[model samples]
Target: MIILFRIRRWLFKYIYHLIIILSLPLISLFSYNHLLNNHYHPKLINYTTLNQLYINNNTLFDNLFHSNKITSKFPISERSFSSLNDDVFQYGCRDPIMESSKNKRLNAAFVVLARNTEIDGVILSMRSLERRFNQWFNYPWIFLNDEPFNDEFKSRVEEVSSGEINFGLINSLNWHFPNNLENSPFFNEVVENQGDRGIMYGNMKSYHNMCRFYSGFFFEHPLIKDLEFYWRVEPDVEFYCDLTYDPFLEMKKNNKKYGFTITIKELINTVPNLFKLTNKFIIENNIKLPDTWSLFSNNMKFFKGENEINYKDVKNLDDFFRNLIKNTKYNYAKNVINNNNSDNDKQIPSKLLSKLNKLIINHSNSLPKSINEKFNDESYNLCHFWSNFEIASNELFTSPQYKAYYKFLEDSNGFFTERWGDAPIHSLAAGMFLNLSEIHYFRDIGYKHSTIGHCPYNSPNQLPYIPSDKFKHQVLPQDEIYMSEIDPPIKNPLINSNLGASGCRCRCPSDHREVENSGGSCSSLWLKLNDNNFPNSNSLTNHQLNLDLIENWALNSLMDWINNNGNIDDWEISQSERDLLSKNVI
Candidate 1:
């Protein structure tokens, strides 16, 4: 039995990896005809050239291995544990007067989509989180689906959670796209030409935007406001920590508003002079910048690009922002520009100040959207948006911020239509503007929900469904039920007393504890059935089967699922055939 189990596990591992790497579309072209739906009667032999895309090929085993990278042990020093009080990371130090702690740990829930096989790891990670922070969680749980949360999925999830797990019914109207909008010119052109190459390109663009727009603005919607931190748990993700700390407070205290696990450059050309524009704004508003805002350093030295661009010249967006920090007006340095000697570099002065001002003036005169102060309004800071990781606040999603970030970057996609993702865009924005103290890496602490071990913890060997005794520390409610009421929001420190801004960790840690840490879905099978995930004949058939289930004309959740669910079976059509079918169906 042991040998058989090991064999089964190995088989599952390789098979799953191969499937993702080779792709269902490729599999169908080579082998899966038997899985095709019966009614795919096509009138013509659809064949078109697939514009093959070449990416920096990441391998199957490496991809899988990367998922296991979080640390299993905390990296704190002996001095850390001995000198620091728990109050820094924990909810309270027992300050009896101000109620010690507000005691408002969220009854946070997760909404994950799954299909094919049962996903067991995600729930297990959550169980671990509850056990380590039971005293902090004061809320319920919710699970949703594009399909019914089968008894198997629900029971298994609840069993591991050790808490009430409520399953939500995704109304079809809320789940799928309505078959109207054929009247609107833009959307109509999108629909009518979908069968032509015209539609596939557009749908792909629109679908990508759907995720980006949501990541950028989901907080304003009524659906998730009650929950303070919605830790997005996707299928096949991992976690590894006791999580004795509360991230929400970290976000609150240091004003490390937006939290992300990974950072990457923005698509070039999306916002070319983004940096120059920011400098313009700062100078105009006379906002006090970090002290290190100087461009050059040393005894008459030559830094590359020092003659033209004040900061070191760079080819990638990451380097550009990395250089921006020195010119930032509010850092560890207080002297705006103190080189004890006379400097005559024109480029140096611009990068330090003038270039950014130029962008501000140009943008101010160019667009209305860029002019709105609400563009920087704090109300929209989504406390739980994730790109490669979680972003806690609205600290990085400003228009001018994005505009200033793309100076050295260019959109990979030539048209620039499907270029910047919210994650990359915001990362650049924060990189150029955020103070290092304002960014909490939680290196010593960790979390469990990110992919490739970008989180704070270790990946458990058990399935996502297993709620082992290791997770016993979590506190659970007796009733496997949830109240239909929304949770009261955790108070916003920046909004209440501060003027749309939270104080930074600008100073040093008062306690040693403040020093210890850092660390740290598909629902669908909840997606609507789209043929592209299947091979040609099979995909054609599933399209007809799912036709009647459509609903919600605007934020059509079905359209999203069809576009994203990794059924892979959909991408099997010959490039031309896929285009024709995608255009007509989507």
Candidate 2:
């Protein structure tokens, strides 16, 4: 009897182990199906219970792993379950390296958007500039992709752009973890997490790259580190305004390092993960971070709990991220208020806020913008549009002092998560490191999905803040570009794009250094130019004019176009700039 009982116990143990093994694939299959059958969004939970589950060891795994039975389909596949390593995208490099530093070059390359563009978009955008203002493509364009650039894509861009292009490959290695799915330790758990919006716990290479971008900025990519300036471009992008000065020259003169378009509350989708990495940074980098780096509110309304929100209150954030904070007049009055001794050195309640903010932002409280202005050394500030559309020489990129740039990004394990992209971080880093006067906001460049804008002649400090003139304090040094407003806005527009399409213009309102183009729609000029009969040729090429005359003609013509077109759509050409720029026939 005793022998038989012992045998039964041993058999039962073996059976249990076998059952667990058999369930692994089934779990993965079911999880994948669930995600495919449903939309990928997290169900709401009570903050108290969420906190409890986070701390309670027993409920932690169960709550996190409890799958929500849902399904998804193919078209969504591209944007779906980015955390998994199943499939990814690729970017292209037009040719090898056209230019590089003498003693440096690594696996570095910039990803420029160059796909799904209009048939005559490139020519049209260029022609729009030419008919209105003859100009060359100022910034180097980079192309990125999940697949290789076919002859058609490459050939088309080459012919249209006159070979003005470079490419980056977003292969499995670069876009995702190098680990194999079969051998991964977290295989089961990753399967369980398939439906999660945040692509954590899997082989999401782009996510990883984005994280590293925020924390470990890349000044050393084989393609980028050696070059000081990178002008981010994308397919189907547009430029409606005429440029009077060289943005690249301004960037060099002022010492401004990075630039960007928008700044939203970075904590929305990033607080939890940002906290995870930031905590690691505190413990690992050995650098002393300021107090108030991470603060959370009990109220969800502030962060647009369930819907898209524009922030109306910039004054309430200073105490939460003290180190990176820029105390402007508006900030002191709006953000800091009377709290003289707020404890800024506390953990930010990352998980408390949702990814959206419903607040109606008051730009009047912002700092002066450098939209149409040139760089001014006396004040040493860099605030303007297309801050991200940059131009840098090899010398600026290879500077030894720039070592800190990429170091910060790599250390944060930032390149491993998909929740955050590198845009906001890059903007912040540039604003902080680049000299104020050296920074520039390109007043001419235009992108369809841009968040920042530098209108012609709109110098820094031209604009007033949204609420209080004192609210200008909320911005960081880098964000000087979007700090101020000249006349208050009727409204601020939303700028968006595909993944890495245009660069990630992260919403780090914490620094208030966002670049924006009050573009609720296309500039009126673009609308006039959209007529099929718009000039398809560059007449300036045949003119016997000197460089100065060429530039003046272009500038005046562009201004005329803006006047006639009313500055609404980006490239509409129905209204001509000055009835006619020149009568000399091409």
Candidate 3:
């Protein structure tokens, strides 16, 4: 009886192996035919139709990624698998290194500010931009550095790119520390105070030089002067979508002067003196002030039924303001924030107001008195466009108005005596000089640098059916969503906030935590899909069938599939096709 049972087990195992071997070719043919016919219904999609759809979907992904709705470990599910199909097509096509379009009208290039040590990061950013957007347009790229780029850095970048490339060195004059101040008491005090504050690069003279150069000198560089527009790219940044349309052309058509993807409040400590300096500039240059400027002034006359200040006193206010800041501690107001525990107690008190009155600026009695409240207002020095990703008219930076504005600030010596970031400097230039119509928020472009990312939350199609755990540290801000006719009302962030909380290190808000012991769809799906030792109870023949199918699809082309199957459309995608692609078989 034992001999008979052993013989029977051996026979079963052998038959299973034979069946898997016999079915491999048939499975491959089926998967090939399914992928070819599934979405290739001419009426539904072709390369042209899919290209436009991919662009729109890519924009949605931008918003999704930025909001941290997706993360590095996130996996594509059945629903999202189709959305990412363009990426597969791009890989399979081995598309030619596209030549610049002969009829391309806009003269634009990507400008990179980087160091030689950052070559690897720069290459990665370049590859992403090329794969996502620039490959088709073939826009030139200009690399700028304080020091000359080495031969190796130039060669690597050139090899990866087909576009015209130019490398330039930052002029020393633009990078020079403010002169005649080596022994100045105030300058030394500023440096010492900054070092004590623990601000990143606060004590570094090179960082200050870089900030000042970018503020007033980059667009003036000889390499960029001939171009009408530029897209500022940096090392290690990511571009996450297929940019089917030309953004430079979009800027030209719409008459856009500046475009940015992210805007956040700047650290108040970095620019304590910036607002005062700006006021002085307005007075010296006789620059027309925007209505929002009233937000900074305490004059009741500007408000109906409020008292007005003496016009003469306000005009001669520069010296008084200078004296106040000179007497004030560096970043004094910001330090007060850390000393105080309650946000509601943030109003500038009577003593501070009395002094500020002499300077013609007062936050007391303002509609929103605290930094957190009026953060988006131009009067608030804390508001700024994140400048890492910028698309703008070259004229915006080189125009006479901007030059005069920058010169006025430079003369104040704020760049060295105080830490002023280029982000706020660029933000102020756009906010103060350009009309609202000329400034654009490019929510369509997906961008990531460091920890923060953003995507437009407008289209329902833009969001995944399943939320990603990427926003584990910070809950997605609901207010950022822009509802459209087609977009579904935004999902409640709280729903997914707690899905995997037990493992998350972040101290997120309590309301945002996942329900105890309950794993939501995103977390559950992530485990099932990503675990290398995923539990499987399938027969050997079925496993072999899936492996063969995926292998045939990736190595073969759509043409090969179509040749085998003949003309067909609207066929259902096979289970193997969906699983294989989502599992990274292709």
Candidate 4:
């Protein structure tokens, strides 16, 4: 009996040990997975947890990742830690105060022109805007389509929008080629030629129709006509930052007529004759040029025998003209410079000299023969506020001046033959009609459309860490960082009070910089012409400033000469200098 009892005890002890040994691998695997699923997966962290983390400590990382429990159990390398912080930085910190109903809302609606196939893309844009801005204001949205919106598109968009949603069919007259031109062979030929030349959206009749519609008729639509203001949103575009305040209210409060986020040069080929047509209309109607007109006019100054053609002042003229001519075709340079004057030594007529100066300054090597030939003395700089995104009072478009301008362009058939884009049209009209102060640049908004995007960074003083080669791949500890850490804590240039954070919860790249002067952006020119402050303007060298000043003087002189009917007497040149000018024909 004693032996049997001892044998049972030994078996029980050995079996228990065997069971624990068999489960060891499984237990370790489960533990590892749990740590990864809970700690590594950022999506698992809910907004509530994030808000809690923010509340516990003002910083996102100090409380959550820096906790000893998480650090010890799930070790993170410095690079991984930095990457995690970057990922969190994208969400930015949201402001609950933005949810207050006491905030005044604007009588504005978001206008989207899309087709059924773009429903998914439209949903993304709608959801992004709702989360970023509209959730706070609850403004209504109006969707316009050439065809009826399908149930799926309507339901899906409705599901994402926080505000009341309405769908309307665009009038056929507004969205199609005019009945007179629909079957015109000339129109077809132009389309075919532009397509063959590979102009963006040049061959697509529907694309041109869409551009024309947006430029002339969208604002007049019944659904949008009643609204005081409209924000044009497009499919697949993204709003990367939180807009804590109502942009419509901002527009109204500041008496702004137009607002845009991205400014870029238009494809010169797409709008070959637009500038000429616009110039002609201005002259015929005696349209008063706005101060902002300089934004569109080329600022290059070519000597018109105004000042004694000092060799010192014109030393760089050779290189400047050389580079300009070299970039364009030889034939084009000849056409612009020849001016039918066979005699090269005799004094050129003041009229001919003025024409030559205007041609040289207005000419752009980038333009094709078709476009270059249309350059007037007051040439378009082609710096246009991209129209894909616009916030403006509806009154701006419905005004008689803009209406007449649109009608003139439409009657000329440039929208059909030349594939003129609405972007440049809107830009030119705004420059002509609105004051510099009336047109707002939404610098605080972070936006991305296809390849081009603008991601804003805080001022250098407000940056949490100044990126350097030494810490290029490292994220500094954000412990004990207060909102005051950002010098001034509130930098809303437009609004004086502390409203919801303007760019809160942005998920853009930490290293992404604003390409204001490069990559086809013309914001630099816009700033210089309007005298608005540019971020990098202070970095310009004194030599660059001198060159700019010279160009400005030249532009003003040329305009004055033209306005005065080529009279050199107004220039106050001495008779000897006038003789010297007359002796040379450039």
Candidate 5:
């Protein structure tokens, strides 16, 4: 009996040990799944649970993956998901159902500015837009060129376009340099210098003419003068997704004046005096700046320590104005003030002189604020909407305020001297004249110009796989070669549709981070400054919203770190690291 008891006890003990060993993998899988679910589906998990999970496992995963790099770079407190508000993520069509129902076609057209040589590129753009959105609405397309369109270009574009097409020649007065400066030696020298410096398209006089024309005169073209809205289309550019609804109508219904897919920082050298000139205009006109104007200004204190002047002190105020006027970049304004006919022969407008005097008087007592605060410094963040893919109301450009503003800049001859781009010109005008609510970010539109592009992904919980068979052999007629070369076979057919709604039949990869989430984009900053009047229509739950907010914050922090500490080109991921990242849900 004693021998039997000893054997049984030994067997029971060993069996229990064996059971625990066998169950370890199952326990591990459960734990991993729990963490992942919390990570991706913040909506499903409570805030307290997510915070606890982040606190415990963030350190453990630090070495496991570089995905944690963003969180690791910033302090845990600043990036904690718990600190973000639920409302920050709310944007876009405030009342989707209501807006969706009012589908009356807007009085809009796709305006393409191209040369005759760009027939093939124009057809590609026309066909893509037709297939994606214009076929259903049949919005007219108005084509304008510096010269008359040839028969071949017209025929090919009409053949591919779904809507009525009209071709027009740009007026010589509008397309060429102003008569006063056409042959000026100073103007010629500036153009030559710009080319020598390798500024983008600065060497090309036609490019400068194009920028100047678009900045001030395109909206008034005879072909499109009566039209209320226009979607600027460029040759060789692409629209990557199927737009299910009419964007023009959407803009009209929502009272949005401007819509864009990308916002980037403009090259500072291209517009050395743009901000200074813009600030001068703002103060002179006493224009009511938008609340979002703060995004453009760093709000750096102009005077520090003992140098700060009391607003009531007359001597101090005179000294400040004298320094400011002497330091100002508007030499044209100075010439007019000094009555230097040698520099500029035209008399300064009485209205302008009065406004200039008012500017000095108004700002004498105190330092200029808002757009005016950084007058002597590089105040502009250089953020601009890429005007190449703009959908905007014609009235925005044609408005009297804008026309005056453009004239002011044009008279300064900055277009020839500094190579001012239309993108920044349009952006600054939009920033000054329109409220944040008037601007719209087309998150759904996947657009590419030159080498840069924006591709939006599906939401996290949606269908994660894009069926490869759907796009395998599909190619637009005549676009087969270009399509094939640009879009290769999808190696990873997986996508997360639960994150956001991509356009219907979008062939582009839907798994990449959006431009708005990247460091280079100013869209997030734009949204952050959005007016609170818009209603919340985002369907994302609180936790899901928090996840997006956290991700954007982290990515921005990472980019800022890269810009300050190291070269972005030097920051690269290895194939192994990519593979590891691919295996895990980001």
Candidate 6:
């Protein structure tokens, strides 16, 4: 009886083993389908956990083999999962050195103007550039400081950077009071007495040196001389989106000479006589250049007697029109006004003259305010391209016109005595020498310095803090055709062309108008994602897309709301966790 019982147990064990082996393929099939179907989606967990499951720990053979039931609501498919392989990922990230063909293309590098004290902030900026744009480009970085970079600063920056890193000391001559000004009593007195002038950086000798270097010598630095294009990066600036294509390549292909992310009006006090100096330089140098509107030439022959032509002094509308054509200082100005006129000035109709007189009188008073009343033809309040973030062709600086312009400004000693910012200087040069077509506004770039900031995401779903003056800060003309705002979710054309166009259809039933009408902040953003007509709505279309990011952003919003509304402890919390926090131990 005992032997029979042992036989029965052995038979039962054999049957159980056989059944388990037979079900193995079925279990694998079910799990494979579950992964393929994207059913096991996690709702609200920290991004660390999500990244671990999604990005890092990709291999899960044990879990797949043991569990017969389908799990995992994550939307990842086989294609998405496999693409994260180191080789695939790195190749897609655009390492220019690896692609032999790109080497023969444009010579470009990132130029960082900073001091040794700003090394930490510089590293952060570099890391952001690498992750967003430069990793693929593998563009070299040139660091310039008025003072020599310390070893620690050099090593730390090198460690975080993937591309070639170069450190350069500003020429002592470039960073000090010029030989002409060093012995001047006036310069010394102004530097000493201007400390309390309330002008930003007006009194700092070092600041003057910094501005002078950028204006006259940054592009000429030996480390930067070979590159045809340089993207100026500042310490602590952030890049908000992924850049798939090479911006340098775009600039080269499109013949873009000057690119700026932000443009703001310079303080009037900072560049009080900048326009007078610029006009004098243009006139004295005999420089003539073509721009978007008309040819700007140092040829003052156009307005030789403009100030003397008193329109109000004319006796009648017919007399005003007659004198305007005959006594005008510039033939070009007269032709522009009288092209529609009849051949006989004597027979000019009263009706036409009345209209012409009104137009002249109205526009005469409404003309743009000029820095110098004598040079009212050229208005200058120092609207400049912020040099803090700029990308430009080397020719913009290296050309004869630009070189002469810089030399003229350098000789005047305005940089030392007044707080002349490099931004205004660069902007004025570009505006005068380069065509509007050559000047591009990088509206998509996320830029911030000190108190000001800008993001391309017009309605950001996830920014931690929004600048109060974001909408008010006028970087470009409101109606500028080329500088139009591209709504979020669409891959910035400046970043990627195909990715944005391939995004999903808007899933929202209501349009952007409806979303705006809703009037709630988060709700409006959410509805914008759903509005199909809205650009980049596909950025949020996928069910499992960026879920962790969204959740984290939502949590941040909740915390902010709670903080702004009342005490943090007002929210539901376990008594044990609170007690542990109060005692500093469990």
Please tell me which predicted candidate would have the highest lDDT against the true structure: 4
* Per-candidate local distance difference test: 0.33, 0.32, 0.52, 0.61, 0.60, 0.52
Summarize candidate 2's per-residue lDDT along 1-586 as a digit string, tens digits: 9999999999999999999999999998787554333321111222333335334533212112211211111111111111111111111111111112122322222335334443344433433322111122223445655456667766655543422467655444444434674246554344335326553433453344434432333334455555555555433344433233334444544454443322223323432343334334335545432211111111111112111122222221121111112221122223322232366654323331111011113334343343211111011111122223434343444555334544554444434433444544443334334432333323223333434332221111111112221121322333233222111111112212121111111112221211221222111111112223223221121221122332245444434554585331232222132123222222
- Evaluated at residue 103, the lDDT of candidate 1 is 42
Model 2 regions more than 4 Å off: 1-134, 137-147, 162-172, 180-222, 275-418, 431-447, 450-586
Residues 52-157 of candidate 5 have per-residue lDDT tens digits of: 5334422222221112343234212112111111111221112222333466667889999999998888877876777555655567889999999988998777
lDDT of 6: 0.52
lDDT of 2: 0.32
Per model, state how many residue pairs clash. 69, 130, 9, 4, 9, 12
Q: Which stretches of candidate 3 lie over 4 Å from their true place?
A: 1-105, 178-189, 290-381, 457-586
Off by over 4 Å in 6: 1-105, 292-376, 458-586
TM-score of candidate 3 to 2 decimals: 0.51
- Worst lDDT window (10 residues) for model 2? 70-79
Candidate 4 lDDT, tens digit per residue, 215-300?
99998999998889999999998776556656787677777888988888888888778988999999889988776676676523
For model 4, name the residue pairs that clash.
90-507, 91-505, 92-505, 347-582
Question: What would the per-residue lDDT of candidate 1 be over residues 1-586, giving only the tens digit for each residue?
Answer: 9999999999999999988987967866554233221121111111111101111122111111112231112121111111111112331122211221454544344444343154465455455445433323323455545467666677666655644566654444333333363234654444334335442334454443334433343433334445555544455443323333456655665566445443222333333333334444555555554311211001111122222233323222222223332232221112222331237443234443453345444533533333212122111111111353463453343345444433223322211233234444444345446543454443323333332232221211111122233244333341111111111112223222111111111111112121112222110000111112223322222232111121112113323433585221122222332223233332
lDDT score, residue 372, model 6?
A: 31
For residues 117-140, write the lDDT of model 6, one tens digit per residue: 888788778766765555545677
Instruction: Please give each candidate's TM-score.
Output: 0.36, 0.37, 0.51, 0.61, 0.60, 0.51
If ranked by TM-score, best first, what sequence of candidates would result? 4, 5, 6, 3, 2, 1
Candidate 4 worst ten-residue window by lDDT: 78-87
In candidate 1, position 71 carries an lDDT of 11
